[model samples]
Target: MIYSGTYTAIKADVPEFFMRKFIKLERIRANRESIQKKLNKKWLTCGIFTCVAAIAMIGSYRYISGIVKVSSNVNGKELPIYCVQTDEKKVALSFDAAWGNDDTQRILDILKEHNVHVTFFMTGGWVESYPDDVKAIYEAGHDLGNHSQNHKNMSQLSDEEKTQELMSVHEKVKELTGVKMQLFRPPYGDYDNAVVLNARENGYYPIQWDVDSLDWKDYGTDSILNTVLNHKALGNGSIILCHNGAKYTADALDALLDGLKEKGYQVVPISQLIYKENYHMDVTGRQIPDAK
Candidate 1:
């Protein structure tokens, strides 16, 4: 009986020991699975962070390069016809008429006496205030060019506004004089690429000046004469700027014409001086004839 009882106890102890060992092994496996999960999650987070940083770097590079391209384009900006490239001893004298009509007849008489015709860029208000002067200028055999309607800065206008500014004065001049003007000068000498391109699209040649008489300063007759005569930009194909509204432009007109003639420069209108077709403008805004 004693031996049988001892064998039974040993068998019972063996099964209990095996069951405890199996429980311990299961606990270890569970702990190992938890550690592996944590490691996988940490690695995934690091990978995501690295990818985000790389994407940010690429975006910054593109933005900086885009700025560089814009600046480069500005370097080669569009320009108007400041002058012409020609070997002829000819120049153009242009008068901007935005205000006043007191000296209009005097100017016409002086021009007729000199047998010289010049370009007159008139604003819409001027045309309205002095229709007879417009007719007088055209009748006297001069080029009537378009100065923007309201005398606003053309560079600041929208595309449609720019076209309106040009065509408004154009239609007014056309109706008054029965002349479709092909020349346009922006108010305040202000322009951008849109201004120039829109003018061309509307059948106009955008004009600017190389020689400024500074007659608008109302200094005196001698100042106007001295400025135009001694201007450094006075060379072949120079376009001179004057304002008829100035206090002394009419007074200085006769002497200025005589001075220009003495210098052996034939003062012609802008139409005769500029090349209408097959021409290109350089960076200095000089119109150049293309190779034949």
Candidate 2:
């Protein structure tokens, strides 16, 4: 026979001892399920919070350490040596030679007259067209720097292409002058982390200028002189940019050298101005010597 009744009727019919045990067991089960649910919810929330916190910490680290995206394919920051950190009154003058060589001899003569040794960053085409000048620069105690093969924007090239751009010119300069170039300057001043890192991997110190003469603008000789001499960035470890093909650069060279000398600045080639080892670059691209 089956018994059917309301919950209250069933409860009334049950023995008191068994009923008390059933009620206690039901309460314990409910409490256990409720506690388990609360624990699960709390664990889920903590897991999500921990994941979010980890992500935030990584982003903050990247931001504070000057880590940047150079391109879609490359990450992290690698800056070229724009200038050096020093207390000595010294600076480097660098000239990029990508085109015409009409004024190169004249510029060399002026540098010789002043007993100043400067760096000449030359393209492969320029080196090919003016091999004699390349030899002359090497013989005259000037720095021969690689300015790439086709003078393309380094930041736009692939890893292999960038290496070719650097090494092709490197081999050419080496074969022509028997000098292995160790300095590289990107064309049009365009570079990224890849451009700089590739140069370093290939045993070249990537160079950039802090002080720009604006000589490429063809403003005039006086304008070039004034722009360079009065540049606020002109300091003890400044690197000044000029071009061998600029219209007014050769004209302004003598006065620029004289003015720099008058200002108690010793001008030298890039090789002499930079630290060869144990150095690090700051966020602004200034190379600092690691404290011993």
Candidate 3:
């Protein structure tokens, strides 16, 4: 009953029909995927461009104005109180003590003679090494700040490590001197956002220096004296950095104090010079009070 052309043709037509439809469906799917890839790439490029533009705008804003002062945190980055923004002709002299006690007594003697109170940033190692000197510094009424436990670069420390570094020294100093330190100076002046944030969490104000006495180079008395005295940044609310182990620091101490006094600069401890609350640090590390 099969018709020669009719039945044979219908049988062939059924398979051919499905094959064409299958090929067409495959083509549509391929085209859809191609479009999706192009769209994804375009979106990615746009997103990157937007981010770069935003960063550029923020950088421009910061440049035109000094660093944008926020609360304790600034755009997630924290800043240290380097110097105060005060019109009073006052400055803070700080000595970082990490090693060697030879100059400790001599420096203390000179400071006593001048009747000048300075801050001494001491580490836990320094405290353990010279407990007597630690007590002496506290007894002499100098600002004792925590300078970490091992003097490692705090920027590289983890949050827990930073807390330990800060608190270990904090406890050590408190136990030895009965004084709870509220100030912190990162070792070698090394700090990052995390370091400052950790310091805040531990209730310590991070400190930095505006004027540096290059006495650490053992640059002799004249060189040290000139650098400290003639620094262009020498002004009201300046913080000067010195090291207790510096070879010429003790030698330069007398001349340095006399020069500052002659210039009508009232040198005081960091505690007396810094504002504890409602302060913001400028790009130059000048801490300006919110009320000001």
Q: Which candidate gets the maximum TM-score versus the true structure? A: 3
Full-model lDDT for every candidate: 0.89, 0.90, 0.89
TM-score of each: 0.74, 0.75, 0.75
**On residues 62-158, what C-alpha lDDT tens digit does candidate 3 reach at each position?**
7645444445555565789878888899999999999888999999999999999999999899999999999999899899999999999998878
Model 1, 1-292: lDDT tens digits are 3234544555665786775575567668878999999999999999999999999999999776555432212346767789989999999999999998889899999999999999999999899999999999999999999998999999999999999988998999999989999999999999988888889889998899999999898889999999999999899999999988899999999999999999999999999999887666666888877656
Model 2 TM-score relative to the real fold: 0.75
RMSD to true structure for each model, in Å? 13.3, 8.3, 13.0
- Who is ahead in TM-score, 1 or 3? 3
Report how far residue 169 has shifted in candidate 1, in Å: 1.2
Q: Where in model 2 is the C-alpha error above 4 Å?
A: 1-75
Order the candidates by TM-score, highest first — what do you get?
A: 3, 2, 1
Show model 1 residue runs off by greater than 4 Å.
1-75
Best first by lDDT, ranked: 2, 1, 3
Model 3 regions more than 4 Å off:
1-76
Backbone clash total, candidate 2? 0
For candidate 3, the TM-score is 0.75
